[model samples]
Structure formats: C-alpha cells, structure tokens
Target: MNDTVPPPEVIYVDTHKVACNGGGGALGHPLVYIELGAEGTAECGYCDRKFVHKDHAHEYHDPSPRPEGEH
Candidate 1:
C-alpha cells in the first residue's frame, strides 16, 4: 500500500512553547516544533514505522500563518 507524506528532514527546534496541558502536565501533541533541515528517514510514533521519504510517511504540514498573523 502506498500513502503520501512529506519527505523527512532534520528539523531544528526553533521555539519551545510551554503551556499547561489539560492536566497532569501532559501535552496534547509533541511539546516541540522543528524546522526541516535536510531529507532523511521519518519515524511514526504511532506504529514505529520508518518512512524513508516524505511521501512514504504520509505527513503533511500547514504553513499557514496564525489568525493574528503570527509566525
């Protein structure tokens, strides 16, 4: 089966947003955001599968700006 996803790359941590997750200091998603650096293998935390390319990982990113036009 073939699924489409963005190619994996070395993403760097650009900023760390510290917000209180609903409770117990948990996070609804990953606690970090990264900037893609170079192409590489991508990993799926859900199934622990290694995707060699972006199309294989089935990952998509929305680079839309925030409502307040924040980056």
Candidate 2:
C-alpha cells in the first residue's frame, strides 16, 4: 500500500465562476466552466485541479457553511 500523500493542486480564485482548459498547450482539454457554488470550491472536469476561494483558505478540509443570501 502506498501511503504517499500527493499535494493537492490548489488555485486561489476570486470569482465564483471559473473557466479551465487544462492550462492549454500540450496537455490540455476542452474548455469548461466551473462554479464554486456554496462550497466555495470547484474541480476541473478534465485535469481535476482544485479551485479554492481565498476566503476558505484556512478551512479547506471542512468547508464552511455558505454565506447567507447566496444561492
């Protein structure tokens, strides 16, 4: 059993909506838009990169409750 823990690739985002295309170039995929939603994080469908909001940097493990008045 491999107990190695690979470091998560986290991209801090300011906006709730983010577009990802696997960073383009050689290893890239079709563009897709990811919405952070209430969790304040979204993962790319192609590359599986984790997108985390700046506000939720500390509580990355346990996502905080969504802010009031947000859908």
Candidate 3:
C-alpha cells in the first residue's frame, strides 16, 4: 500500500462567511455554514477541507501561487 499522504484541498474564499456541503454531489454532506475567524482560515468538520481567506491565501498551503495585491 502507498504510504504517501495527499495534501488537503485548499479553497480561497473572499468572504469570511462560507457554506460547505461537500461540494454538492453524490459524496456531499449536509449543508453547513463556516466562519473564518480572526485566524482567517476554517476547516470543514465534515469534509476536512481547508478554507482560507483570499487576502491570506499565501499564509496557508495554497496550490496556486498568486502575486502580491492580486486575488
């Protein structure tokens, strides 16, 4: 068995308030609202997906590399 661990998915959100339902599909879960506190990041309790504030995306493990001042 492969012991390598895959990286967690990171979503950059513009607003502090966000709703997650496992992306809404066959593997989706109940709709839930998540708030990004002062830390500027939140993880879905059901899916474990990481939501990072767009302004602080660089601070997290974001796959996309964005230049300064650019969303």
Candidate 4:
C-alpha cells in the first residue's frame, strides 16, 4: 500500500457527481483520492473526481433505479 499524507488538490470534473461536498452543496463531501507518483504530488494520483477511487465513491449507490431499458 502507499504511505502518504492528504493534501488540498484542485478538482473540477465538469459536474458535482464527483463533488466531495454533498453534490456540489455547502456540505462539501471532499472527493475520495489515493496517492500516486513518487509521493504527494500530481506526478500520479487517483481522485474520485477523475474516476479515481471509484470503489470508495460507490459506498452508497443511488437509491433511484435505472430506466426501464437501462442497466
């Protein structure tokens, strides 16, 4: 596993779906992330905002179901 510390990184995923703070609301849910690169640098990273730590974000799935023909 990677041993790293968290930092304040910039994230803009077009929509709040990746919003860490409660769906772009004032709550601020801080997108999930994992350290990449040599250390705590942009060299490499996994942030939920950019499809990183996708599993973590899936902790709570949307209660609503998909459309009749959708999965």
**Ten residues in sequence with the least summed lDDT for candidate 3:** 2-11
Best candidate per TM-score, number?
3
Off by over 4 Å in 2: 1-8, 62-71
Q: Give each model's clash number.
A: 6, 0, 0, 4
CA lDDT for candidate 4? 0.35
Which of the two candidates, 2 or 4, achieves a greater lDDT against the reference? 2
Q: Can you rank all candidates by TM-score, best first? A: 3, 2, 1, 4
The list of candidate 1 runs beyond 4 A from truth reads 1-37, 54-71
Task: Kindly list the per-residue Cα lDDT of model 4 for residues 1-70, writing each as its tens digit.
Answer: 7564433343323222332432445645555533422221221233322222333443423334356766
- Model 3 vs. true fold: TM: 0.72
RMSD of 4: 11.9
Model 3 CA deviation exceeding 4 Å by range: 1-7, 62-71
Best lDDT among the predictions, by candidate number: 3
Window of ten residues with lowest summed lDDT in model 2: 62-71
lDDT of candidate 3 over 1-71, digit per residue (tens): 86744335678899999999998999989999999989899889988878889998777765544688765
lDDT of each: 0.33, 0.76, 0.82, 0.35
For model 4, the run of ten residues with the poorest summed lDDT? 36-45
Q: Assess every candidate by TM-score.
A: 0.22, 0.70, 0.72, 0.19
